[model samples]
Target chain A: MVLLLVAPAVAAGIVLLLPSARAIMRFCAMGTITTATVAACCAWRTFAGGSLQAGEWFRMDMLSAWHLVLMAGVFSAVSLYAVGYFSKELESGAFSRGKAARYAALWFGAMDAMTVVLLTDNLGVMWVGIEATTLLTAFMILTHSSPASLEAMWKYLLMCSVGVALAFIGVILAAASAESAGLTGAQVLSWTHLLDAAGSLSSAHVKMAFIFAVVGYGTKAGLAPMHSWLPDAHSQAPAPVSAMFSAFMLNAALYCVLRSLALVEAVTGSDGWGREVLLVLGLVSVLLAAVFIVGQRDIKRLLAYSSVEHIGLIAVGIGLGGAGAAAALLHAMNHSVAKTLSFMSAGRIGQAYGTNDMRRISGALHAEPLWGTGLLLGIMMLAGMAPFGIFLSEFLILKSALEGGRYLLAGALLAGLVAVFVGVMRHAIGVSWGAHEGIVRNVGAGWLDRFLVAGAILVSLVLGIWPCSRLWHVLEMASALTGGMP
Target chain B: MMPLVDSVHVLILVTCLLLLGSSRLGACIRTVAIQGIVAGGVLPWVSSLHISMQLLFTGVFVMALKGIVFPVLLSRAMREASASREMSPFVGYGTSLMAGVLFFLASLWLGAKLPTPDGVSGLAVPTACMMVSTGLFLIIARRLAVTQVIGYIVVENGIYALGLAVAHDIPVLVELGAMLDAFVAVFVMGIAIFHINREFDHMDSGRLNVLKG
Candidate 1:
């Protein structure tokens, strides 16, 4: 378990020390991330049997294990695609060797920090890990240091830091709640300890902690009204980093929320109070993203808004509990795979066009066939079109809602989904087949990119057509940890 | 003892209003510094629990970082940004001060609803809530990046006070770890401010409308 944490740091150190052959350095970085992914997968498979493992400072349970697998899968894919991304940039003289080195180093660093966030049993340490991700990736967003990139980095740092500071207070409150029941030190912030003492914990203090947890971590998760930082940071960042940010970072924050939700639910002895908060916030985020998606002009910004919507849906799924939690976890998994593909393809397309402006790009298929197809397929999948797991997960969420007799909630969610679907698919096609000449043609999507994008799409398609029963079982068990019964 | 804690809480609210009403960047940073010191000073006396080594450490760490280290870094960034005052705020100072008063009333009402634990100062929750709202107001109402950073620190101080009130048993390691994280966050933002100033030649986050919908 410790090696899972240290492997990336070790890899980053070696990558930093290696002579800067573009292929050599990237391969070394990829190799270590792959190792970490494998370790995480092993842990995931074992933990799926519902075993809980505890270290002195960290713990692995169903919730963390599920996210560990999802995060590792996304990180592995991004890293492989990143090789292609930076290679194209390098060949085109867009990135110097040193710049590429920094990207590789920080890429692994960000991965390491997120891994820590999932693994830490201590909520405060988890806050530190989230803060560390902010710092590590803030630089990643400023890889080019354009005035715009600098501004993005500034807002990302400030907003996330402030959000995270509030989260620390949440952690403190959580600790206080547990301590009022007489737990101390590590046990105060330890999830299992809090769980054990949930009944004796001050319900009001836990309630306060849970609200701050929702708002604070929700802010980091790109929840609406607090999602002001997402679009800028996502758009300004390099595509691979943007992919990681969208795919894993937000999920990690929500994973923190889920940890607190379990505590809150146990204390209250049901899912009524805190889950309502999640449901309402989830609905607001969906509506907010739907409205923004209609007026979005930047391609990355569009994808970013879509991310907010997907995150919201996942929130709603978990908030609904029972089957909804299972669906939400599945949706998180599906969104991770689909969204990474979109960002990678978008990055490729943007590089080829020298712009991310939707109006400025068209006929991407005519310019770069592989990336263009990936972009189209990825967006279609994300818009919850058929034959994609996103569609299935979303359907399950609405079904669970209707089954539970949440007609108004279901209706509002369906309406938002339809509006966003039309808007996103229209914008996606407008880029792939609309009208314009692109300058840097056909240079982006190398064979590696094609393979990775195809692999991601294939995964999404497979999950939709017939998801592995094993995967469903894992997600079900994971949801159960958060007071959901599958 | 409780009165001393109440004084600190009152002073924090005053700082919140000052920050909301002041347009001068330097004054806001200084006011945040003062808030930090007040917050740190109240820490030792406010907790009904006897001071432990962990409490002592958290006090010194927050004082050094929030009280002294952060303000110095923020002021230096202000100097480097070269803009000393917000040219025009989104919400003018007068209106923001009104918002501060309303936030105070709301916090008082909220504090009344959530029963305060015996032995803690009654004003802790209200002051913390007001400070958080004022910090958010500064972030939304001010135009300068530096002021936004100042607002962020204010918000953290508010959360810090809340932590002090409700969570004295928070492990020393977590407290120090959190303070360290906050310090590093401010440091990174300060560096970003320097870059934003140098690149755009101004500190106005309002003009950062390039990536808007």
Candidate 2:
């Protein structure tokens, strides 16, 4: 377990020894793949043998295991894509060896930080991990620095920093609430001890902690109002970085919120107070994203808004409880896969057409078949199209919401989803089939691109149709940890 | 000890007001640096506290980083940006100072409502809350990116104070980790401000409005 945490930090340093930019990218990809393989093994052990603990500070349970696997999966895919993505920049002399080295180092550094977030039992340690991520990934948005990218990086760094600092207050309050539990130093902030002593916690303190945590971590998780930094950062970052941001980084922050939600629900005796808070934030995020998506011109910004909507959907799913929580977990995975495809496609399309404006870059299918289809299908899946994993998860969430007698929530959610579907599909259609007037910059794709696109599409299809029983069982186990079980 | 803690608390409150009312970037940076030092001192100065090796190490580290290192870094960034005085702020200095007083009263009300943990000073919670509000207000009302970074550090100081008052028993490792993260956060923000100044030829963050919906 320690090896899983230490390996990435080691790889971050190891990339410095590489000879060239290409070599650095390949080395980093290989490094992430190796660490991801180890993470997968640990996750398997956790699921089969129950939670695994390291020393007294770190532990991996079903919840962390689920997120661990998701992180590993997303990182592996995006790391490979980074090699492909940066190669084009390399050819154009846009990406230098130094920039590549920094990117690779920060990439591994972020992986280590996120691993700490997933594996730690200490809530304070988790808070530290989230703050570290905000700092480490801040420069990644400025890979090819511009005024806009700098603006985005600045906003991301300060907003997330201030937001996560507020979360520290929540952690302190939670620890103070646990003081009555008589745990000694350090253990007072341990999630396990807090869970064990949840019943005796002061309700008012717990309520305050939950609110601060949701708003703070929710800011990083790209929930609405606080989601202002997200679209700008996503649209400005290099495509692979943006993919990783949308795919796993946001989920990592939300993972912190889930841990807090579990503790708060336990303290509140499962009266759905925490869940209702998530429901309102989730719905607000969905509606707000819908409003933005309808008028967005930048393709990357559109996908970024879509990420907010999907994150909102996942929050709503978990908020609905029971089967909804499980469905929400599945939705997280599906959104990661589809988002990776869409962002990668949009990035390559932008590279070809020299712009990201949906109206300007048209006839994508004619210019670049692979990524055009990827973007089209990716957007369709993100819009919760039938025969996709997102659609299945969305259906299950709505079903569970109705089953739980939340007709109003169900109605509002359905309306938001439909609005997003129409809004996104219109753009997707024009971008995929509209007329092309200018000479396209033909960028060649390697086997890695083909493999990623094919793999993501296949996974989305199989997960939608089959809804594998093993994954569902694990999802249920993880959702149960979130206090969403009936 | 009680007298010392009370004086340190007063120093923190005064620095917060100074931060809100000061128009010059240098004064704002110095005010926050002093605030950080005074706030860091609270962890060790409280009379009801027990001292350990960990607490001693944390006190020295916090004081060194917040009081000295952060100020040096921010001052350098300000020099590089060649920007001074927050002219034409979103909220005028007089109004900001008035708002600061209102925020302090609100913090006092909030502090009274929330239960203060045993052994902590009665004023600590309200003081920390005021720091948080002041930091947030500066972030929202300031025009320069450098001031925003200062605002962030002020917020970190507030949280650190809150942690000391509310949960002093946090593991040393976690506490150090949080502190280190804050240090790096300031470092990174410093680099960002430098870059923003070079790219836009100004530090006016309010003008960074190219990527809107």
Candidate 3:
């Protein structure tokens, strides 16, 4: 867990010492892989029911353990993909080595900051971590000096900064609410203590606090109304960075929301108002994403909207409560893996075609088989096709909704999912099949690319077919920690 | 001292209104600076210690950074950009001023409704909330990037004011960290504005609409 928090800092230090961009890329790749290994081991230990608490500042419980594993795994793949991507850019002289080195350093820094957000139990410190990630990644999004990139970066910064400020207000209010309950000192803001003293905390204050936090973090999670900046940022950013943003950063923000949800649920009992809010936001996000994806010209922007859709689905799952929360948690993991694969494949395809515009690119299968295959399979999985983990989790979500007698909601969700499937499949088929018209240049594929594509596909497939006892145990423990049914 | 702190709140409220009412970027920057000074002035008054070496030094830093350093940085950037006036905003200045008034009143109402945390001054919470929201409103309403940055600084000042209100046993280092982070955020914003001006040939964020979906 400590390694997860500090790996990026260590990588940054080493990268700073490296003389060349190639060396920096190699170091980052190695460092992130090591971090991923450590995180996996930590997750295993935590899954075996081992717990570690670093004072009151940080804790690795079952919930955080799952997030840690996902974050490390996704970031590791992104780092390796970045190495290949940046090296190509460097060799082609697209950017200076110095800029590439700086990007690598900040990339690891962002990973480290996000790791802290996952591991830390303190709400204030978690805000700090999230804020730090924002600062770090905002620059990464603007690696290029285009006007569009700058605008996207600024929009990202301003909107997220405002959103985070509101979140801080929520934190202050939560602390204030706890103080109103006669709790004093550090106990007033501690998550554990707040849960213990939930009955004493004012429900009205808690409700207000949750509203602000959900809006604030929900902005980061790419929920609608506040999701205006996401498409621009994700599409404008480099591909590997885009992968990281979709695959894990959104999940990190969702984790913060879930944490607050736990507190809010404890205080308000099963009032379901919070769940209703989540459901509303979720459905809106899906419907909006489906509409936008249909007209999306840029492949990256299409993927970005897909992220909004997936996040919406996860939110809806969480809102359904009971078994839905478990399904959502599982969906979160599956989506991260599948989305990373999708973005990485998209990045490679975008590079090969020399454009991200779907209109300009065609016959990706004939052009680059591995990338084309990856994009096809990944999108199919994201669209919730059978035999993928997303399919299973999404099915479970529908089952839970029906079981809960939310048939109308289940119907709407199914409609949205189907709309998304049609939209994405249309684009994917258009991009992946047919005659190759564009000049296809062979950009030599790397081992890392194969590893990511194969590994993600294998994981999704295995999770779809069989549920490992270890994963089940971890999910059970996580559900308990979240105060939801497993 | 208490009266001065209360009056500072009123001054901040007025400055926030003036900011929304102003069309000129220079005037907006000036209004924000004055708001910052009022915010800095209230900090020492809210603290328990009347006089101390550390407190005195912090006040000096606040005055220098928030009052002098930030405004100057913003002014220089505006001068370099050579865009003095904000022609039109998403919302007109008069409407924004009205919105600012509503925000202040709403904040006051919110403060009155909530139970105060221990050691928090009666005046500070509402004042801080008002200042924060006003700052947010300015950022949203203002067209020019530089003015929006000034608005961000004003919001940070309000957050600092909240920190002062609830200081109690809050460590000086944490306060310093927050201050330093705010300073850096504005500093980075200044650099970003410069880059924006150079790239886009205008600091008006209204013109930055190339990446729409």
Task: TM-score for candidate 2, please give it.
Answer: 0.98
Whole-model lDDT, model 3: 0.82
lDDT of each: 0.84, 0.90, 0.82
Q: Which one is best on lDDT?
A: 2
Candidate 1 lDDT over residue span A448-471, tens digit each: 776797799889999999998987
Best model number under DockQ = 2
Better of 1 and 2 by lDDT: 2
Candidate 1: pairs in clash: none
Which candidate, 2 or 3, would have the higher DockQ against the true structure?
Answer: 2
**Candidates ranked, most accurate by DockQ first:** 2, 1, 3
lDDT of 3 by residue, A138-200 (tens): 889878778888899888887887787777667766776775567766666678788889998
Which 10 consecutive positions of candidate 2 chain A have the poorest summed lDDT?
A176-185
- Scoring the B chain of model 2 against the true B chain gives a TM-score of 0.96
Candidate 3 lDDT at A141 equals 88
Per-residue C-alpha lDDT of model 2 across residues A166-203, encoded as one tens digit per residue: 99889888887877777778788889988998888877
Docking class of 2: high
Better of 2 and 3 by TM-score: 2
TM-scores of the candidates, chain A only = 0.97, 0.99, 0.97
lDDT of 1 at A183: 88
